[model samples]
Target: MNTHTRKLIKLNAREGLGVSIILVILFVFLSVSSEYFLTVENITNLLMHSVFVMLVAFGVMFVLSTGGIDLSVGSVLGLCGGVTGWLMMNGTNMWLAILAGLLLGTLIGAFNGMIITRLRISPFLATFAMLYIARGLLLLFTINEPIRNFATPEFAFLAQGYWLGIPMPVWIALAVFLICYFLFNSTSFGRFVVAVGSNQEAAHLSGISTNSIKIRVYALSGLLAASAGILLSSRLTAVQPLMGTSYELDAIAAAVIGGTSMFGGKGSVTGVAIGAIILALISNGLDLLAVNQFYRLIITGLIIIIAVGVERYTSTRAKTA
Candidate 1:
């Protein structure tokens, strides 16, 4: 391999090492502070809970890598989950309902992309509007009632089943991470995303279809969010209209903590997986410590702020160097 390729690999390795260190530090601290933190059961449960966040984080990472954001993901999750649950409760085929939910998510994402790319709407504004719209639709469909009677054994297995001694969600999460890692690291589409994020105008000048890329990214984001929703509903054996409220923040936190620049053009799928784990550890640890939910939210916010601050500092240092 060439020197440039070697240097790139080393840089990525360093970044991965940095994230690993943070994860280790957090794990050790939690284990020390809470007697039950290292228990096998707790660890298993933590991984299960984190799967949804990891999936959503992967999607958000894609949008952020393209210098865009999708604020509607959480709402889309709720809507899709609600729809799926409602359908199943009403006797629809399980696989068919799931596919319908995923399709709905993709369509919403496409709409968001179309408005932002073709109509020149800002990503934030467009997705912000979508957030409310999706939530409203969720409430309308469920009529504010949670769907609980649709938990067929096969349906519940999607989230709670075991495959070769590992939770099904863990395997699913790993598959998503691997797929996204390949897409972001080894594909021409990934290169296009980076180029567009680094400079949209320049990418457009070079004949890259920036609009199409943005649309595709957002659609992927929606699809992942829907998948998360499906798993969540399965885990709970119910789907509440407001089930995904505030989840977007967690996904964004994961992406940012994983070293995805808010300004775009920098990200790592592996780093994001680690970030999701860190967030899960924090939540799990706080619960073990009997910390108040309110305090947990405050602490999570603080962590996001600190992570963003560190990103800015590192970016500035790199620019100067």
Candidate 2:
């Protein structure tokens, strides 16, 4: 590898090492503690089920890297999935329905961009409002009914089919991971996002079009959220209005745990992927150990705090170093 590529690998390693170690430790502990944890079936299920949050986390990572947050992704996922299912139920072509659903998500994200850029609303508030609006629209559209029995074989294959003896969701997640890794690590768009997050005013003064960057990031966030929704619609035969409720927590937790700073300017796609795996492990371990599922939420919250604190400490050390 060239010097720059080597340095990047080192940096990503440095940032992601702690979480990686944690993942290994967790994996070993769970394997020893539970007979069910290390089985091929259980392991595959854990990884497969994690694709939804993992997909959403990838989108949220870009938004977080831009020093912004998107609270609407969960709702976006629900709405988009509902839309796709509803369309298919109404006899719309599967690919066409999926396209419309994806377009809907992208538009919602673009609208988020417009509101934040034009109205000067904080990202938190803008997306928070959008969360409710999207959810409400979904409820009205579905009449709070579950959209069921719309699964076509092609649609079903995305989340349910296997290739090379591995699950399709795992493959999809891997493809997304590879694509995002390149974007975050090797592209000008990535550099611009970090620059804008590092200092919006400086980026603007440097002719970076800060607003445009923010808009695109939000749009990307929406598209990815919609992707997760589409996958969910494929996996499940039904789409409920609130099916994606609170998934933003998982997305944020994964991004933060992966060493993406909430204060912005830094991100690692590999880190986010590892973080998602860690989360999946935690939940699976809890289930295997017969722990109350509510404890999972508490554990997730604690992880977020610890991740944020670690981020702060690491940032301080870097500044001083």
Candidate 3:
């Protein structure tokens, strides 16, 4: 590879390496601190538990790559889950309900994309507005009550059951990562997203349709967020309106921690996955160590700051080189 290509690869690897190193450190710490931490069951539980966050992170990375943020993902997730629950409880077909939920999420994403691109509003503001709007709709539709799942036993399998000794949610997350990996690395549209993120005027001058790409990116983010909601609802057998509150922050943190650029034009699906795992490991290990929840938040914040700072340093060095 040429020097420029090698530098790009190195930059990508650098973003991901922190999470890998942290995971190993956390694993060793947990293994020493708690007998249950390294057990097969605990490890399975940890991976299973991180499924939702990981799924959200994968999609968010794409949005970030286009220099956009979607604060509405968690709210959209809650709204989708609530709709799915409401439909199933009223004797709707499970398959149709799931599809409808996903569609709803896509529409929500499209709306955000439209408002941002057409109206020239900042994506941050547009998605932030949708966050409140979605949350309000979720609560109103559910009458402020959790919607319990009354669907067939088969429906529960999607979220809680395992295939080949692996939880379905984790498999779903893996599928999400794989799809995003291809979408970001192998698709022309993905190329446009990066191009626009790097320079909107330049991309437009080059005949790329930046607006359409932004809309698609946000829509995909919504679809993934809906998937997360659906799986969580299935696992809990209920859709709680407040279920995904603050989850957007967690997903964004995971993406940022994984080495995705907040300023856009940079990131990877794999990096986001590693970041999600690191976040999960931190929470899991801390719980094992009986650390305070408040302290966990503080530590998470510190780690994000350090990660971003390191990324900034490396990015600057890469530019200088």
Candidate with best lDDT: 2
lDDT of 1 by residue, 1-321 (tens): 698797766666666555566678878988898899898889988998889999999999999999899899999998998888899999999999999989998999999999999999999999999999999988888775668899899999999899988899999999999999999999999889989999999999999999999999999999999999988989888877789998898899898888887788988899889889888888898899999888998887776676656655654554454
Error of 2 at 76 (Å): 0.4
lDDT of 2 at 272: 89
Enumerate clash totals for all models, in the order shown. Answer: 0, 0, 0
The lDDT per prediction is 0.88, 0.89, 0.86
- What shift in Å separates residue 291 of candidate 2 from its native position after superposition? 1.5
Candidate 2: stretches off by over 4 Å: 1-9, 307-321
TM-score of each: 0.94, 0.94, 0.94
What range of 10 consecutive residues in model 3 has the weakest lDDT sum?
310-319
| Model 1 Cα shift for residue 39 (angstroms) | 2.0
Kindly list the per-residue Cα lDDT of model 2 for residues 6-89, writing each as its tens digit. Answer: 776665556776677678888899999999888889989999978899999999999999999999999999999999999999
Q: Candidate 1 or 3, higher lDDT?
A: 1
Candidate 2 similarity to native, TM-score:
0.94
Off by over 4 Å in 1: 311-321
